[model samples]
Every structure is written in C-alpha cells, then in structure tokens.
Target: MFNVYITKAGKYLPNEAVSNDEMEGILGMINDTASKARRIVLRNNGITSRYYAIKDGIITHNNAQLTHLAIEQLYDSRFTKNDVELLSCGTSSPDNLFPSHAAMVHGLMDNRSLELNSSSGVCCAGMNALKYGFLSVKSGNTSNAVCTGSERSSTWMLADKFNNEVINLKNLEEQPIIAFKKDFLRWMLSDGAGALLLENEPAGDISLKIEWMESFSYAHELEACMYAGGDKMDDGNIKPWQDYQAEEWLKQSVFAVKQDVKLLEKYVLKLGAKSTKIALDKHGVSDSDIDYLLPHVSSNFFATRLYDALLEEGIDLPNDKWFMNLSTVGNVGSASIYLMVEEIMASRKLKKGQKLLLIVPESGRFTYSIAYLTVC
Candidate 1:
C-alpha cells in the first residue's frame, strides 16, 4: 500500500467576519423581536465572530461556490486543480437536493474530468471524505485526491425562512416566538469552506502523513439528535421533507436546522471518548503518543466535558495539547476540522515526528470519527 500525505490545506471564509453583536442584524430578528436564546447560546459557545454568505437577503456564495473557492487556493507551484485524480466533498448543507454536492463543486472547477464522491452527514462528513481520498490513494487507485468540507448555513438561518412559521402561529392566536430548538442554532453556525490536497508523496518541507482513520456509529442504540430537511416523529424516526405537504414545509420551517439539546448533552462526549479509546487501542496508539489533539468541538461548552470524558476512558491528554478554533470561526459543521487543521499547518508549530490525533463527534444519532496523523 502507498503512504498518503496531505500536501496542502486551503480554506475560504466568505466575506468579512460578523461579530456576535451583529448577528441579529444580518440574520435579522424573528418577528421583529430579538431572540431570547441568542445571548445565552453565544455565551456558552464562546464564538466571538463568524462569517456569512448573505448580503441584503441575497446569497453571496452558495455551498458549491464556497467549496470551489477553497479548492482554488490549494493550487500552487507543485500542484494544480487539473492534477487531481479524484475529488471528494462533504457538507451538511448543499445548494440542492438533486445534484450531488461534489458534482456541483466539480462543475465550478476549471479542471479536467475526475472521479467525484459526496458524503452526507453532519460534522463527520468531512472526515469521511478525507478517508475516501486516503484509501483511494493507499490502494494505488489514484495518485492524488482533493477532499473538501463546507457549509452555507446562513441560507437556512435567514429570518425570512422563519417568518412563515411566525405568521402561521400568529394566525392561530398562538405565541409568535419560534421554538428554542430552532432559534438556538442561529447564533451558533456560520459559513466557511476548507479543502485538503492529498498526494502519494510528501510535499514541500512539511506534510502530514495519515496513519489511520476510524469511524463509529451508535445509531443502533440511539435516536437522531440534530437534523434538518425532516421532522422527527414520536417514535424516534425522521419524516423526510417529501413526506409532508407543500404548505406544511414553510409553516413548519421544515428545512431549518434543529437539535435535541438533551440528547446531545447525554451522549456526544461519552460516545466520542469511548470511540477514541477503541480506535487508539485498535491501532495500538497510546494517549501519551499524541502530541496534538485537534478535536472538532461544536462549542466551547463541551471542551472541559470532553477532556474529562477522555480521562474517564483512561486517555489522559492534557488541555495544553488540545487545539480548536471554534471560538473565532463559529461552528461550520463538517468544515470545522478542516479549518482547524489548515490554521495549525499555517502556524508552523508542528515538529517532525509529532503525532496529531483528530476527534470529530456528531450528536446526529451519536456518531464519531477519529484520525491519526504524523508530521513529516
């Protein structure tokens, strides 16, 4: 098998950074009233600023465009877009349902025809895309691959999307306030895209050698916790958007992202830590061997909790070794990990032979993905 290395990392955060106080202005207030949960959620998530792809109710860049922009930055003296043999993309929010996200991204690229793959999930989708690229190169099926993760959540979080629900509720003389489940995500998510170019050989003076990657799902024992484009049934099943009538779509804000906060509190860290221990043991990598911990923490609220959970599992990595950028970038779902890795690589803090452990936890039915890399 060939050894695959991440030769370059690129990211594109759309437009300017929007501060916490300016969020409601861009997203607009629901029902002309500020959200009661926005401040509380922001305080807990610890996000100071974030980006948006919207301006005056018009989308500046769709998910495909954001991804294309990120991929363009990956080109340099040694590698270019046309040199890619495979392209794998992942995202929680795609521009359309018919054309796969990868296909749309490829359509925007000024490159030759290449193999494409699109992974669909919440946060773990990005890692899954990277895994596909790594394996394709390892098996000698391709010499190089470009993997990306991006999100354009602003399109769904706009106040106009929720206006219909408010109108429907007011018509019935009910409270005009949207549910906390729906309002909670508005202040928590932002727009961005990140990409990685993987090649069979290490490039430049620094490259990350992918040692191993593992994924685990507890869906067999858990129910969905975070979702969109569907409604959750009482029996723990998600009813797809197509299952409901057209009128109910806007009235229910069916496409707006929602989460069961209680479920996330119960399982996200516990399941993630357990999976980390399993992957470490399976690969014979001890916690002490990890020089850096790049965790895709959705919020700062879970940072201390996750550190303690890993301790409970006999993995005692210290806080100094942890790395995250959620506070400045906001939660970009699948793109979070890629952005973190890109920032760290640009920082030039990594030393040769150092080990990097990446953990991505998704509360969507309790899923986790772990990857191990060595600096070369």
Candidate 2:
C-alpha cells in the first residue's frame, strides 16, 4: 500500500470575535425579552466563543472570501497555483447556485491545471473528502491535493425572521421559547474555514502519514436531519428542528463510533499492526504506543460522550491524547478533524515514530470513519 501524508495545513478565522455575552446583546436587540433571549443562547448550544468574518470590525464574510483566505493561508506562496493537481472544497455554503465553490476556489487560485470538486455532506464533508482524496492519490491519479472546508453561517442567519417568531414577551418570560425558529438558528450554525494540503511525500514540516481510511453511511436516517427548498437568501438553511437535537444525534453518533472501532480493529489485525488486547489495554503506555488521538469535534457534548464510550470499550486514553479545540474554534464541520490534527502538530506535542488515530462521526445518523497515522 502507498503512503499518503499531510504536507501542510492552515486555518483562517474572520478578524472579529463574538463572545456569548455579545451574541446575547445582539439577540436582545431583535427580541423584546432580553433576559429570556440570553437564557436561550446559553441553554441550547455549549458554544462560548466563535470567530466571524468582519467588514470594518463587523462580522460578515461570504463563502467565497472565506475559502480564498483559508487557501491563501494554507498555500503561503510555497507552491504556485499550477502545481496543485486537485482542489476540492467541502462546504455547505457556496457563493452561488452554479459554478460551485470548488470552481470559485479554482478561480481564486488562478491555476489552469487544478481539477475542482465540491461536496455538501453537511459537517462530514471534510472527512468524506479526505477519504476520496486519499483514494485518488493511491490510485496514481494525483500526487498533490488541496482540501478546504469553509462556512459563513452568520450570513445565512435570518435574524428578522427569528425575532418575528417571538409572539409574546411575557409568554417568553414564563416559559422557554418552544418556537422552532430560535432553536434551529442556534443549533445548525457556525462560521470558519480550514484548509489542508496532502502530498505523496513529506513537504515542509511533516504532520503525519495516512495509513488507512474508511467511511460508512447510514442512509436510512437521512431525514433525521435535513434542509430542503430555500431561495438564495435562505440558502443552505436546514429544517425539521430535530436536526439540531443534540441528544438524539448523540445516540446515533455513539453507535457510529463503536462500529468504526470494530472496523479499525479488523484493519489492524489484518495488517498485523497490533493485537486487540494491546490496543484496548488500560495501561497508559497506549499513549506511548499511539502518539495522538484526533476525534471528530461534533460538539463539546458529543466529544465528552464519545470519550466516555471509549472508556466503556476498555480503551484508556488520557485527556492529553485527545486534540479538542472546539471550545476555541467551534465546529468547522468536516474540517474539525483535520484542524485538530494541525493543532496537535503545531503545538509541538507529536514526536517522530508515534502513531495517531483519527476518528470522525457523521452527524444526523450513525456513520463514522477511522484512519491511522504515523509520525514520519
């Protein structure tokens, strides 16, 4: 089997920062009951702070701009545009109905040799794209690839529609807003972009080499979370409210994680990599055996639940092995796993010869992906 390595990685966030308190104030300006609005913000999502694109200190940037900036940060003039073999953008937000975000990124790069593709698998686009890209590289179809996942949820958020749903200020004061409007708005929304460059050989500072990649889909639960039929103004808006129900998604997510672990166990056993007992042993030496762990950043709640599930499986891993920065960056959909890998490498924690395990759970259903990496 051929080895696929991550040559470089980059992340970009809008200049303006929005804390929970500021968000509450903004919500209050549009809603009558400011206190109730604040509570709504606190209870629904565990997000404390998230980055936003800004125009003159105001939070706003379209998908095109975010994609361009993220790529620029990743490329950093190290390679010319023509050097790129594949340019893929995994995003829920595209600037237009046609041309696709991948085409837009290609134009931004101004390179003629780049082949472009776009994916819209919600938050899982990042991991799914990587799996596809690795296959392309292993098949000798491409030697270099760039994968980017970007979103500008703030632009799509309809604040006016949200405030109008508040029927009675007194009613809100007495009870929680049962309106689907506010809850949906808070749930399936976040903004940021992450880009990664993959090559057959190590480039600059090598992060980790890709040893294996796999993906599973649970199409039966597709309707568990979905968005359909909206104009350009409301483009990419998800619906049915149940999509943002974290508790419901958690059950399916855990099932996916266990399934992926079983698959990984099979892969490792086939390759004679490690015995089942060694892999699941409670000893802290598992860290010495496998250098790092990068799990999907679905949410803080999801991360905690996944960690607990791993413990139940007899996989003892310290908090230090987990690369979780969602509290600082929020969830960048598919970009979350790759971004976590970048964070771990940049922190100078990963040493040579150590193995890293990458895990991602797709939202809305019980599907997951697992990949193993070794530091080169």
Best by TM-score: 1
State how far residue 136 of model 2 sits from its true place (Å): 1.4
Candidate 1 yields a Cα-based lDDT of 0.93
Instruction: Give candidate 1 regions above 4 Å deviation.
Output: none
- Measured by TM-score, how close is model 2 to the native structure? 0.75
> What lDDT does the true structure give each of the candidates?
0.93, 0.60
Expressed as tens digits, the lDDT of each residue in 1-376 for candidate 2 is 4568787777777766667766534323334434443455345446677765544435567787777777776655667667789887887666787888888777777667666778776666776667667777767789978888787765444344344334343345644242333344443356778877778887775557877665555544232232322211233223332444454332222111111223222232222122222333423334456667776654554555555556655565678777777777766666667668768878877778888877666543444666778787
Deviation from native of the Cα of residue 142 in model 2, angstroms: 0.9
- TM-score for every candidate vs. truth? 0.99, 0.75
Mind giving the per-residue lDDT tens digits that candidate 1 earns over 152-233?
9987888999999999999999999999989999988899999999999999878999999999999999999999989899
